[model samples]
Target: AQSVTQLDSHVSVSEGTPVLLRCNYSSSYSPSLFWYVQHPNKGLQLLLKYTSAATLVKGINGFEAEFKKSETSFHLTKPSAHMSDAAEYFCVVSDPGGGYNKLIFGAGTRLAVHP
Candidate 1:
């Protein structure tokens, strides 16, 4: 069984500061990882993903994550945070089996931006 844990339920950032969200996972085999963001009442959008190609993956909105197999961690980071960056972020892990993907979603991290 694989699972993901979000270290913090909420994160607050200043308008122009950097943003960091922590995530940890436990999996029997190497799994695919992803980060998705959702605004107030909008749908979820893919921030980035790692599918066994590159250890470092970049996504939209200047966000990126590095796959650290040894640490079993995939943390999301942004060089600078913007007002629009304020949203709920989810860390997800998927296992590819028999030509199918089983996804496990994280609880979610709520990001608050202060002006």
Candidate 2:
């Protein structure tokens, strides 16, 4: 079984400050990891993904994550925080054995950007 755990349920940051969202995963095989953001009244958007192509993966909107096999971590980071970045972020893991579409979603971490 593959699963993901969001370390923080809520993260707060001031505008223009650095942001960090931690995630840990457990899988029997080499798994794919992803970060998805869901804004209020909006659909979930793919922030980034790690599929063995690279350890460091960059995504849209100044977001990026590094896959660390030893640490079993895929933490999301940003240089600066923006008000627009506030949303519910979900750390996801793919269930390769089940199917490509089979995914395990974390509870979610709500990001709050204070002015």
List per-prediction Cα lDDT, in the order shown.
Answer: 0.92, 0.95
- State model 1's lDDT: 0.92
TM-score of each prediction: 0.94, 0.96
Candidate 2, 1-115: lDDT as tens digits: 8999999999999999999999999999898999999999999999999998989999999999999999999999999999999999999998888555588999999999999
Q: State the local distance difference test value for candidate 2.
A: 0.95
Candidate 2 residue 111 C-alpha distance from true site, Å: 0.2
Judging by lDDT against the true structure, name the best candidate: 2
lDDT of 1 by residue, 24-108 (tens): 9888777899999999999999999998899999999999998999999999999889999999999999966565888889999
Model 1: lDDT of residue 80: 89
Q: For model 2, what is the alpha-carbon lDDT of residue 11?
A: 99
How high a TM-score does candidate 1 get? 0.94
Q: Which stretches of candidate 2 lie over 4 Å from their true place?
A: 99-101
